[model samples]
Target: METRPRGRDGTGVTNTDAGPGLVEPVPGYRTRVVDEGARDGPAVVLLHGTPLDLRAWDPLVPALRATRRVVRFDARGHGVAEDVPVPDVGRLAADVVAVLDHLGVADAHVVGHSWGGEIAQRVAVEHPGRVARLSLVCTRASPFPPFGELAASLRGGTVDLEALLGRWFTPAERAEPAGAAATVRAWLRDADRERWAEALDMIATFDGLADLAAVAAPADVVVAELDAVATPAHMAEIARTLPDAACHVLPGARHLAPLQHADAIARVLLA
Candidate 1:
């Protein structure tokens, strides 16, 4: 049975394509993909973060799908893991291309959040022709420092999830029963521990600051004013590195902007 994707209301969102289904972008690596929205609109491919699945972008879908062909899928190892290699930033970017090839989409606007944003950068830099534009939310182009210690804690089964959640969102957002913070908490709580740890290790090894110059796509950098990890200044610095990019800062926002500021982000993507 498929896990129905719910909206902010807790009841599931309308399955514009009868809900997400399994598709093998690569043989034996079945991925849960949701391909819906306006059939003739420009393609928009959404990539999710490390601990989250396709649902991380759910809140923004309705707004985009009104006039866009929206495609989102679980990262290779998340959701229904099958025959696949260990997760990493580069391999994860390959999965993005595989999905586009499987869908026969020549190019699309790629949007990614957090770890997903890292994958977006890889796609733009390596497979430049496949990306028309980029929307990077709460992300960075440099090596993330804390992942080393975070990976260690994950390996030791000592990650303070509650504290992690606090960093991800504010108390008010977390208190909302069907809001982003709570939903993220559910995802964090249910994540496969070893895979999560391995993914973090992969992230710790990533160093993309030098590669930004190769990304030729027109891009938008979206960051939260209050996000400690992906700070506004850091995100702005990344924007400066890009050949053509604009930075937008959400006042007092935190890490998960898709869920926290979906409408605002949707406007940026559409603009």
Candidate 2:
């Protein structure tokens, strides 16, 4: 296992050839994961969203490693993971479960951002026994209105990455377009658009509001005050449905709060 600094672009870029833990070959793809922490400590899993991989969690890993065994992984078709034939929320959840099983973790606290939040919800609902807690950040319970159309536009390869990212960040962050562009480029380089499209489609059809009531674990909803992608209203609704849940709105933050406000997020998760 090797660790290296990935610069300061919030991209978590690294070229470590060493794969995380054990790679399990699923029917259509293989999953790569990093499992590191004290064996007796509580287990925590970090899931990334579209256009990003496990490295997105780099900002939070160091802090989380102090108290819990931290596990981060690249979703199928992202990062070094193999691209599977079919990509959907259910499949994505299954991939997560597979990683957990591989690591011999029966239960864990799961943290997910953006599209990953949708996968986290599915995992808690479909594999209730495996999830002890959940942290949803900058994500929604269901797909945004007309997400299919939006995805189609994205797939057409005509969308402006800068403009899209601008909507996700605050004005101050947007002012540094070069940094934002670098981050976006890193994601695009590692991401598979077809897989991204499939994941987005799954989110479009997902409805976890009803399932949240059945979750038997605690949940935390972190919303960026200035998030334009996943609005505060969407997070509020998610918090309302959970049986035991709390909300924390990060002031002046944007969609990538976990990266921009990593220390605050660490405090909340560790608390």
**Top TM-score model:** 1
Stretches off by above 4 angstroms in model 2 are: 1-22, 170-181
lDDT scores in order: 0.81, 0.76
Q: Report residue 105 deviation for candidate 2 (angstroms).
A: 0.9
All-Cα superposition RMSD per candidate: 3.4, 4.2
Q: Write the per-residue lDDT of candidate 2 for residues 131-188, one digit (tens) a residue.
A: 9899998988865656676568678986566666666664566566455435655575
lDDT of 1: 0.81
Worst 10 residues of 2 by lDDT: 1-10
* Residue 209 lDDT (model 1): 73
Candidate 1, residues 1-271: lDDT per residue as tens digits?
A: 1243554444443333744366778776886777899879999999877777787787899899979999998886566552244566777889899988987899999999988899999999889999999989998777776887897898798999989998977677678877666777777877777777666666677678779888889999998998887888889898988989988888878888887799889989999
Q: After superposition, how far is residue 73 of candidate 2 from its true place, in Å?
A: 0.9
